[model samples]
Target: MRWKHPVLGEFSNETLIHMAEQNGLIFEVGHFVLHQALKAANDWLAVCPTFCIAINVSSVQLKNSGFVEQIRDLLALYRFPAHQLELEITESGLIVDEPTASDILNRLHILGVTLSLDDFGTGYASFQYLKKFPFDGIKIDKSFMEQIEHSESDQEIVRSMLHVAKKLNLNVVVEGIESTQQEQFILEQGCDVGQGFLYGKPMPSEVFTLKLESHAQA
Candidate 1:
């Protein structure tokens, strides 16, 4: 989310999201984000059956009693495929109300929506989260990639993470993959998916759609 500030111009919503959390407004904000994301994906990628859209989910939104139903209703309303919509939840987000979060996640899984544990390895109880939650995959945090080329410890850490994820049968996606060396290293480590500046920076929806169309034609 981005905010248009009168003094600071446009900025990302990190501060705004903190405020929303403090004010008990994150639930509404989270739902709005999900709704808009699903709507946009449905509108732009309706014909692209292989495309999957991932949305970050918050703890406050997860604990809400109606969260799962909201997702179901939205998918039906948009006529979007449940399996093509991935909800990325952070370890910190799942820390609060574990039982509730687990229940909600289970329900979402039942609906055929993919669930990914986002920013893996940064949180305090990352391993515990893996044991508790029913996650289909994990996105390794970018911190591990920063010094992966030179640091043996970082390399071991990533290898360990990949090993654990593999043992759990979870798909692993490495983040912050900029240089070819970094990409090659993760690829060698058996990470099949990655996202970073190396591939492409963030772009508008129209530009993304055009790229997809071009790729389809190619």
Candidate 2:
């Protein structure tokens, strides 16, 4: 949050953090949000059938000594189904320390919560990390989507990524698709899921709830 009340108003998390005088509260807030993830998943899935939620855990969080137990406790406390939750961890987060990463990743897998390797292509030791960890899926970096249609090389890259996913049996969710053409092309490339402005821009929870209610009614 901003140190001083914004004269213009800060309406988003990014802006709130940007206006902050220091990074002191970010981790605190993030720590809180980790719990909120459980609450949201428990509350939402209670009312809606066949739904899942994804939460990103930072590298710092992953390496925390109690991270897996914290999740285990949260699941027990909230009675949240581990299968209904997916924790997306970045490549850098996992590769920083192998033994620690290996231990926690295994614990997470044993807990039955799905793991996704976030930002698939932009980090170090991508292939090696994938092989070492039991990740359930991959989130293709948006950089490739920057020119998916215009660049044959981009399309080829996308295809190659899809091929890797297939061989590894890891689902692919391509990001940054912003047009009908891009969406169609990504589907043709065998991406399992797509996210970008073409689907919907990020919005406040109130707006999302209204849309969700509308869909439920429909």
Candidate 3:
């Protein structure tokens, strides 16, 4: 999500998120992003109905008092299947409001939308989160993948993550697989899904649809 800045020339998604936080409206912005994801998901599913969409949920969005209702309303508005949607929430975000988070997460789970812990290894008390929250998958942070090929320690770290996800009956997605070697290594270690420039750079919905269509045809 890079954007041309009047002064900075360009800003990345992280910078945008950071800027949003400064304004203290990140929660509101997150809600808008979620709805946009739903719209895109609805678009893709219309063409390739088997497609499953994953959207990140910021902690602020999760902690909002009316989040659950907003989600319910959006799901109804989009007519998107709950089973086809997966929400990825960060570990740091969940600690802000445990009881509320738990209740809302449970409700989302009951709604049949899959949940995942994104950037799994970068936050506090990660292992405990797997036990406390109900998630169907764990997204291995790109930092681990960046070193998985060159660093023996990283290989071991990824292996351990896979083992934990396996034991918990959760799926594993390794992001940032920019090379064939990276893809092979993660697959060999039992990772079930992956995403990176090795596949394609991120693009607008129309471009993504074209790529997906070609992939489907292939």
Candidate 4:
């Protein structure tokens, strides 16, 4: 599988967002690309109402001047509720430029868009850092899920994460789940949500809707 992640160095803000919004799965759009995607949606919001689209925001995007204002403008443009839209920020971005990142995130929280810490365990997993931000949810990375079958360490990691999230009152999403065993394991661990090939590999929105309808009536 071509795991979705930013190239780190090659993409410009425009190119990255265009590629992500047009072709990638739900979560791979680079932060720069997502920023532009929101900007692009302003006109659409004026024409027709729709569900919120989750966008990935980078540390660089957070550090930009007027970032919060830009987000506020976009939110205001849409007639939908604030919770309809969500912004996924990588765990590493939280501490990259600590104060700036925090300020920008805090501002967004005030604006009322849901915030999620993406790829949770992949970054600095300190208790202090977890307490620092206002994240509505944590996306358990696929690496940990992939290890659940054979690795004791992975099992412990998932359990530990679920434990902490419960204590903190946060929603947990286990990503990259590809088996019934994985889904059952996550449920056994008390995780709230999960997504993976076991449910269905990522497909176009129309196909996904058809699958949803079939399952709903099944």
Instruction: Report the C-alpha lDDT of model 1 over 1-218, residue by residue, as the tens digit.
Output: 56678998866555666778899999888888888888889876654777889887877888888999999999999999998999989876787788899999999999999999988999998888888878899999999999999999999999999999999999889999999999999989888899899998766677888888788788
Model 1 residue pairs with clashes? none
Report clash pairs, candidate 4. 17-33
- The window of 10 residues in a row where model 3 has the poorest summed lDDT is 11-20
Question: Measured by TM-score, how close is model 4 to the native structure?
Answer: 0.73
Predicted structure with the largest lDDT when compared to the true one = 1
lDDT for every model? 0.87, 0.77, 0.84, 0.70
lDDT of 4 by residue, 98-164 (tens): 8988888888888898988888888756456668888888888898988788899999988998899
Sort by TM-score, best first: what order?
1, 3, 2, 4
| lDDT by residue for model 2 (42-65), tens | 766655766677777766666667
State every prediction's TM-score relative to the real structure.
Answer: 0.93, 0.87, 0.92, 0.73
**Candidate ranking (lDDT, best to worst):** 1, 3, 2, 4
Better of 1 and 2 by TM-score: 1
Model 3: CA > 4 A from native? 1-10
- Report RMSD (Å) for each prediction in the order shown: 1.7, 3.2, 1.8, 6.6
| Candidate closest to the true structure, highest TM-score | 1
Residue-level lDDT of model 3, residues 1-218, one tens digit each, is 45677987877666776777779988777777778888888888867888888877776777777887888888898989888888888876798888888888989999888999999888768899899988888999999888777899999988998999999999889888899999999889877589889988757778888988888888
- Model 2 vs. true fold: TM: 0.87
